[model samples]
Target: MSLLFENAIGDFELSTATLYSPTNGDLEATRDEPVPIDGIVEYASYHDRLDHPEKDDWIAVPLHESDSAALTGEYIAFTDHALHGEIFVYDDGDDYESIDRDAFVESTLAERVRFWHSDYAPDDPPSYFDSPIAEREPPRRPLSGDDAASFFDELESFVRAEMDAQRDANGEKAAGSTPEALREQGFGAIPSLSSLGQPEDGTYRFRIDDDGDDRAQDRHRYVQREFGIFEGNEVQLFPPNAERAPDAFPIAATVGSIEGRTVRLAVDWHAIEDRSTVGGYLRQKRRGYAVTLLLNSVPYDRELEAIARVRERDDHRALLTGETAVTFGDTAGVKSSQQDVELNQEQELAVSCALLADHLFCIHGPPGTGKTRTLVEVVRRSVQAGDDVLVCADSNQAVDNLVAGSSTAATADERSLHAYAQHGADEFVLRRVNAGNSSNDVVGERYATCDGRADVVAATNSSAATLDREFDVLVLDEATQATCTASCIPLARANKVVLAGDHKQLPPFSATEDPPESAAGMSLFEHLYADGGVYEGVGVQLRTQYRMHRDIAWFSNRRFYDRALRQGRDVASLADRPALVGYDVGGSEETIDHSKRNDAEARLVAHVVDELRTEAGLEAAEIGVITPYTAQVDAVRTKLTAQLERGREVTVDTIDSFQGSEKVAIVISLVRSNADGEVGFLDRPLDGPRRLNVAMTRAERFCALIGDWYTLRDSRGGAGDGTDLYDDLHSFLESTGRLRRVEPEFIPIPE
Candidate 1:
């Protein structure tokens, strides 16, 4: 039996131990054959029945101080425990496994409770185990003088080797490494640069870029390339303007592809390109942590204590909430006398919560409850108080929406009032910052760049965190869709944090089965909102919805929001029209296509949309199509685009994509048409209602639902049916004389 490459540190400790025929991974839980040890004895299993003091099945592997020959690492430990019983391993101590913080947090109480005896070979059985860790600080490897030099050296080597490998593969490098490639001989008046073009599968051609010959590129000359990746585009080339490039200058690329000159990236391109770039930041975050304990750079000492205060104990929740005295416009020493910026009760309360909040505040905003409008108040108030503000969201559109609302240029003569009237309301400052990975092209030229000294900076949360600047307030919009760990990036940069989002909207979709943890898949808004009311209340529930008709909104209001949703005057005017209408599309026994595409239902939705636009005298922009799947969204968009008039544009998107957005009328296509009554996650017990809630409320005037009534409404088929939302809404639709039936005109499924 041998132990090799052991790392004994705080939370992580790895070792390759062998109990059976030299296994490559973790130590065996049990052995086929036992070997004699010097003085090792197995204690009775901890769960062992008979009154054994140490009842666990774990056997402690002794620390052999006398025989240092067995271990090679400074942080290696010999006393390991093992036993492969239920959840935690417990037989032999011979395994190397990576710990998943998310998994640890999500694990059953029994799973976690059983974890201790296996990891910690305690001399005596302890009365209790500490709480599972949800977050940690970024790891710190304090650099020595040698370490700093080594970092540069390694960086240089990595850059050179990586570039060479690409150049060699692309047949671009000269016979001997150019002096320019190895080390530029001297500084050129201008740095020479080129651009990259994909000539072939494995070839990239470099062409000189004349930056009108920007003379600023003249200093250090070498061949260089900087690359950026945003939405839809895989790579963007910013060729150096210099006639020559530095032998080694920073390139804004995850994997350098030099077609340009020197590039001092705005943010760490590596972090954007590959989240797992050198540091364990991403990994720690995935495991449910801010990594606040790892490095102090990101977290202030007070922040560190605050983290512990919230996470280490529940007592702080009560204390923090009890002491919080929130009042709107009270955060800043100066209160705005501008009556033009008056807020509604919920909006004012949300701003007050943010103002009075010492650490955190949550705003529970259902769709169309004016989350963005409330956010505008917070930003203007912050700016009026002379505080730097960073507003962030999960999506680029969400951030842009916030930016448009706060910036004087976008909302100039509109409803929103600017804070700094000194520059006039039409010219108050704002910056629309985006992650380098953002596809700003779709957002128009204004998104490409903005003035740096704007009163408010709106950015994708991750990009906002790398800004190399600080802010007094951090407001995360659409916060429910971001992981708590990722949310910490922006949160750490500000003293106070405010969150706005509806938990019932889309939960974050993760590729990996193991999700990040905090309060268990509940977003930051959800976590704070859950405990806030118990004390003095750290959040204001946005209850006035202006997007959906009173009757159309009734289902979600009664079910999701406890019937507190009030329709604004605009929505109330829609009462004369039918709020909800249903169309049955499975007239022919045709099932949904293999890709979950309901062509028949999709066509009916488009047909209904055209009818609404022409007969109701509504513009195409007034209509929205909501579906459960992406395939259906595309299908509907294609169909609707073909049917609508040349200048008329309609909004078509998946249910999740339509959240935080609204249109006057909504056309929903329920794609699932199965004989077996498969509902396709729409009736997924818990998620079904939430998804349906968002789908139902995006309309202001009329809502037309098209689908298989048998699949949704009558699947269980009884008066007291144990059916779903569709069944309940189906009866309601009947009472309102809004139900219609349509036959399917089947289309071939795409390959």
Candidate 2:
């Protein structure tokens, strides 16, 4: 059998050692045995067991035959005395096999046997063992670099020769033929430069000139007879302006025959530049010429007609020898000329939107302060500047909110930015930055080109490494919630940056040790807010609470807001917004206590479904559920699935899978574990607080939390606090009405 061995190891070191071919029952003394070593090929001497450990005791050896060696019927075989019994050889029709004490082996050598050891060990064999030798016709040498190159050159010459012979096979004189005759012969059928540029000898040098006033000056010049088709059509000879040199020179021009007109030609300036320029510069510049090629025309009459049409409609004229065109705005329309009206200062997002041009703008407001709304408007204006923008969030829910809110007014070209989340790159210059599945590696790889390549790139602190690339503008949403490492790096990439978030809702995770002064001091928020005056001086603070009901906002102010006020923060100002209203679901602790766990969960799920189905009237797809722990996630998934099976249309997902996702309504299960038997919330190390926040907030139209308030409140206080867990829970229930007990009521799961 003939075999070819190609080395697949790209750059690893190669070695030589004894090789045993189990298939042919042949043993070679060294890697280069019977053949000379070539480039990157070497003889193996020692095996590194540690580096290449075998899963089993068995080891495989391979043998290669020389390409030039011819196979002969004659062969030889030999064996060592390490066998416990007699050895037998047989040709299995498919391949040759050698059996020694029931073990199989095949060899290329003809029959011959020799034994050196008396006893045989079937399980393990000694390292050194000599067997047999096989000889065949001498092998031929493989192709060399020079030989391969020459072969390809000869092949190309032959192909060209054959094509030319076929062209002239009709026994008709084709050289110097008329344009119509060339057209009939399939040489100049098209009135474009492509047809005219066909080379008689497969080679041509041509120049087109459309700038000259006279008919003769408009035509193209060809040094070789191969470009004969472009003889008459001047407009098709060169690009709009032949003298307007490109960054890379030497454009290729093509010739063809036009109906009525004798000849026509076309110039592919973009193609010429693309083929000549190296690397990314060519791709960036290709866009301009691609547009030009799509509009180019051939034939003098057609060219003149097109130019006249453009002139009649607008004050546009062909310049630089028809290779370029210039235009002046002559038409007057007030609406078309009007610039975008900036939003009023009273608008909640006005200040943050205005700071899109600032080198750095940090927005720190309490919860319900309209940070997200401000971010959306700023992103809109940033993208309007023809800049590509990337928007990313630490959580999937954040990404979803940004995408959904921004997609409303996007143009067809702008809508393409949404693909960055799925593809990890954007075709449109602007895209929402997404660290898929919380993997920073994806962000790092894609951000390498985020500078001028992308209009905007947004991601969380975990992906801060991506900010290593430079950017024109940067916006950090939910800034206060991010850790220092996650928030600070992206600032390095942007000439102008915006930071918007509520500091009171959540502060950066405190570091275990004080960081060095030179290290930018912990959190990006702290770095900005270190001096209270700096935070107050930067930008606008929106106090509107549009998300919550007025009553809820008012009540929350007295509870959560008042606490922040005690710390000298301005969180209580949102109570004035008329858009905020509150709803009260009357219930008592005794009523809630009588409800079973399953009944409580089911009632909650049904309430959410009914609200989405009837009250808010939202689609089933626009609702989600978030749980803090995997155990709770599994539990909720089961109960929700059962409810859904019974005809409810709501969908439930875990916090981990729900990142970068959004829904109109969300219900969060803050499963408080009593693993330590404490009355308050357990301070268990849980995964994905950021993920939980992202998921819970993503169902933006409405949100609800269901959990043990007491446990959560107690957990918030460090172990040093003397307060009992139940006391913490009472305080929590009084502060925020996120939890409430419900009376047992059998509600039908929505179908």
Candidate 3:
């Protein structure tokens, strides 16, 4: 083998070597194979394993000045003890295989030194073997003048954080444990060696031995914790026993499909040398053998690949630099195509500019502003003009909304993409790419099975990576909830891009507690409104909102949208009702059992929910209770269940989970009512109370905020904009006769 393409670095005894591959895309474990090296390796100073003496597998191979320069690239080596190697290969020159050379070298230097022994050939046993440092700083974005590194860093942080959070939420697990021990702890395990088939045929099947109590009975029970797992979820298949096969590594695979108690995984055959060896290894004890399955929810592997491809495009830089910015109405000189549906002036302008743009276009959509409908119109025109369009959203629900239009009464007359497709106006291929369990799967098969003949494809941003074909236009929905790095996944596959979202609502869900200005939590939609952002001079704002009453929409319009959002529906009939109301409680907020809660405020919330359902005649489904704390949500949910009539249920959730949902009446419990006047995360000092904005906008007719007025009005007085937002809210409520104060006896607080 050529030295540059060789998999082995140092010559060691084959029987004594242990191959190491990536676990969850990180160097977390070992497996079998000749370690393949595909990138350059940097030489860091080496340490002698004899100094520690406890590390028996590590034998420092002395590097001579004569051959150090020739062994610079990556390699696999073995010497005295069990073999362990790093693998980075240019398997296929596709976007995913474009190795970040700087990232590779940094990892090698930080972990351990890899040197080649010139005295021995690949077949000959050379000097001592090399062992990596026991611990390593998680791999970070390499600032190698790569434009896509920032997005990669941010997205990687989210992916890792989400995985860690999920693991913590699911309860911790031991690294190595017996099958019975794991099963006793509610973890799934497959006992007895049966059969392992190849997934190269698009579907892989496996059967477990059915004999003992440990047999595969209810396979679905094994995966009950992971039933919601989507396509491309990470998985690790562990060997029967870690002590017996210390050198054996877990096989890595991605979920393809799940049926009953059976899970189908797409194994990376290129990484594994032979399938028979894996089968033989599992068949060691036959009936006595057991394999443990670990499913990880890190779903951004393809996103990293998408970043590599987007970084190579010239339009990416142009869009960032504002050279390709296209303003609304710039289409005045361009030919306008007739659409089947009638669009308002702003929607017409948005669609026209999107059609005229050769590179990038952005629409700043406020809450309930029909942005999805406008985007659908843009897609309609693009597909009619013979342009293949790809529509992507951060969530599966958002993608469905974009295709079927937002769930609002005013939009009932609006035609959905599926409805349009039913008309057969054009013989175009429309497809939705989603997981097997998604609501859209019943519509048709995934885009991959369409035989390369799709005119329009809609999918979640992460799912868009499954597409191999390119498109003329890419329309991204719910852009505010998506990080710029995640947006690059679909952005790389299209020639021109159009994004529609409301940045004033809740920002992207982040594991980091940093401010929105920080790179850690910023969203792509927020990036467009930043200094010198693409929206600086050319962006369009959808001003009309159709979801809320005029009185209900006024607060968001004046406080968040700068009075730019106009009410689309007339609300003269709601003048007799209390549209915006606040009930003040005198109780103080306290942190109990690591959760923020106020018994007085929670009781008041239950009271309000009762009034809305019984007195106001609103159905249970038309009412929702929103809070900033999970403890508060649980408290209110419990109180409502105990106090409300039997069979009456109301939705209670945190503000973050209720962003895309709306109700006829919304009751909010600001959980941070305290003597210290702390408003907590509700009033963001830097980001302008985004959670509060979402809470207030969710109501269509009636909105009630229950809190300690003194806590909100007097809290955070010295802080910048955050304190002023609360003060303004208090002022608005008082001036409009919406603020109502109640005595302590009105709602009883539990002792």
Per-residue alpha-carbon lDDT of candidate 1 for residues 603-661, written as tens digits (9 for 90 to 100): 78777777776678777777788888877777777776666674237888888788767
Candidate 3 per-residue lDDT, tens place, 1-751, comes to: 1121121224323334332332243332222321222211211112222122333443322222222323322222222222324323222323212223234334432132232311122332223322111011111221234543454455556656655665443333425555567667556544443435444455454444555454445555444442333445654555556566534446655667655555665655565776666645544432333445454443456656776686667667445433333322112112236564556788776776566555566788888787777886788778776788998888877777665543232232244565454323444567778644345432433222354577889888888888899998899988888877678789889987888887777777654444445443566656654333434533578888888878778888988788998878765323346888888778767775467877778788888877776677878888999988888887877788887774137999988889888988889998776656667666665544878888988988888888777777664565422376777888888998988997657785343
Q: After superposition, how far is residue 183 of candidate 2 from its true place, in Å?
A: 65
As a whole number from 0 to 100, the lDDT of residue 55 in candidate 2 is 19
lDDT for each candidate structure = 0.50, 0.36, 0.60
Better of 2 and 3 by TM-score: 3
Off by over 4 Å in 2: 1-359, 365-373, 376-392, 395-428, 431-454, 457-469, 506-522, 530-535, 561-618, 646-668, 673-751
Which candidate number would show the highest lDDT if scored against the true structure?
3
Residue 53 miss distance in model 3 (angstroms): 95
Tens-digit lDDT track of model 2 for 1-751: 0001111111122233222223343432322222211110111111122122321321212222222222121221222224534333334556645445223222222111111001111122222321111111111222245643343243233334333443343212222343345445444222222222343333232333223354544434321122233333222222222355344432334444333223333444555545433222222311112100111112222323322332332211111012121111111110011122433343333432233222334565444444555565555555544443445444545544544433432221122234333332333344334444323333334333434455555554345343446555566666654543344345434445566665434344322211112112234444443333222333445555444333333434453344332122222212222221111222112122222123344445556555556556566666676653554544555556666433235666555466434555667655442323232112322222233334433544456655544344445654422234234334544555434454335334432
Model 1 vs truth, CA RMSD: 23.4
For model 3, the stretches where C-alpha displacement exceeds 4 angstroms are: 1-298, 321-336, 406-415, 423-428, 439-452, 513-516, 529-535, 572-576, 588-594, 646-648, 686-688, 715-722, 748-751
**Given candidate 2, what's the lDDT at residue 612?**
53
Q: What TM-score, to 2 decimals, does candidate 3 have?
A: 0.64
RMSD of each: 23.4, 32.2, 24.2
Count of clashing pairs, candidate 2: 64
